[model samples]
Structures are given as structure tokens and as C-alpha cells.
Target: MTDPERELNFAREIIGQRGFRDVPTDEVLGEAERLLNGWMAGDFRMERPKLYDHYALLLLALLQKNRDLEARIEALEARDA
Candidate 1:
């Protein structure tokens, strides 16, 4: 598979293994920052920079979605209580 596809598949595997509902927002943001920093530092020697950028963006989007779901859950719980 291509680099972007590989990266996305790896991310999916990690999220699936850990269960996305159990993953904290900070952890997701940290992963995104790590990816961005690695890209900035030229850590991926063979992959193009844009690939990492896309990966970072994907993580950020996931983070936002996670936060939104957390908020909704909290609201539902509070309403039920």
C-alpha cells in the first residue's frame, strides 16, 4: 500500500485495538503533535511531507470528533441524572 494508506491503516488498527471511546483527547492531540513534529524534523526519510501532514490532520479531526462525542455523552448522563 501507499504511504498515506499505510499510515491511515496503522492509525485505524491502533484505534481499534485500544477502543476509541477509551482514548483521551489529549492522547490523540499528542499523537498528532508527534506526527507533525516528526514531519518537521524530516523523520520519515522516504515518505513525502504531505503524507505526514495528512496524517496529522486526520488525528486532529478524530480528536475533535472524540471531544464532541464526550460532550454529548456527558449531556445525556446529566440529563438522565
Candidate 2:
């Protein structure tokens, strides 16, 4: 018979050794969270995306950066035009 607790601990240790890190729920944004859910559910066609915690956070940051840049550019154009 397998001890569930022991098995869990062993699995956690293996994950740790494999460089798996935890991302808190609060740290994940809505879009990234949705993306992660879809990725996990295999809802996408073609190649699967990297949906890890770090990847999610990075993607969110990139998206925000893109939004900010676009807004700034639009404001500058409006002011100049």
C-alpha cells in the first residue's frame, strides 16, 4: 500500500529538484490565468504554448508594456496632429 502523504512529499521533492516554482494566485492576472486554464485544458490547436508560471507572468508583463507603449504613442500622435 502506498502512503499518500509520503508519496506527495516525494513528488514535491522531485518537483523542487526539477526547478518547479510556485506562483501565488494573486500574482496571476486574469488574462494569464485564463490562458493557463486553456493551455491546461488543451483548448488550442497546433503547438502548445509555454504556460508555466514564469511564462504567464512574463507574458502579462509584455502585454502590459505593449499596451502602455501604444497608449503613449497615441497620445503623442494626438498631441502632434
Candidate 3:
């Protein structure tokens, strides 16, 4: 099956099993429609690449430098104790 079909099937399975009657299905569907319309209209022409780049940078900075910061803080605390 195509990716869209697969995604829809997955969503349907989850929604069906969870019995999301209390949740606003209309609102969720409307948001999906709006997002698809925006993509079809090319609203993400520049923003998509920027979002990918920014997300990658954020992941790298957080995963790499954050660990270094934690180690440095631990060393400082040990020295003072």
C-alpha cells in the first residue's frame, strides 16, 4: 500500500481501538485538512527546509553539547565537595 494509505490505516486502527468518542474528531480532521491544503498550496516552500535544518541543529546541540554541559557541572560539583 501507498504511504498515505498506510498512514490512514494506522490512524484508523488506533482511533478504532481507543474508541475516541470523547475526543474532537472533527477538529482533528479539520486540522489535517488545513495542513494538507497548506502543503498542496506550497506554503512550506522555504519553511520546510528551514524547519528540517533547525530541528537537526536543535537535536545535535541538545544531544551533543547538553551531555558535555552535564559532565562539566558534575565535575564542578565534585570539586566543591
In order of appearance, the predictions have TM-scores of: 0.40, 0.37, 0.35
Candidate 2 per-residue C-alpha lDDT over 1-81 given as tens digits, one digit per residue, 9 for 90 to 100: 333233122222223344323533233344454544554565522122322324645455557667878999999999999
Root-mean-square deviation of every model:
7.7, 11.9, 13.5
Specify the highest-lDDT model's number. Answer: 1
Q: What ranges in model 1 sit over 4 Å off?
A: 1-48
Candidate 1: RMSD to truth: 7.7
Task: List runs of model 3 lying over 4 Å from the truth.
Answer: 1-50
Instruction: Report lDDT per candidate.
Output: 0.57, 0.45, 0.45
Model 2 worst lDDT window (10 residues): 5-14
Candidate 1 clash figure, as a count: 0
Model 1 over residues 14-58: C-alpha lDDT tens digits? Answer: 355776657666676666556556546755232454454346545
Candidate number with the higher TM-score (1 or 3): 1
Off by over 4 Å in 2: 1-51
lDDT of 3 by residue, 1-81 (tens): 223322222223223455444435453354445544544675422244444433432344345556778999999999999
Model 1: residue 41 alpha-carbon error in angstroms: 29
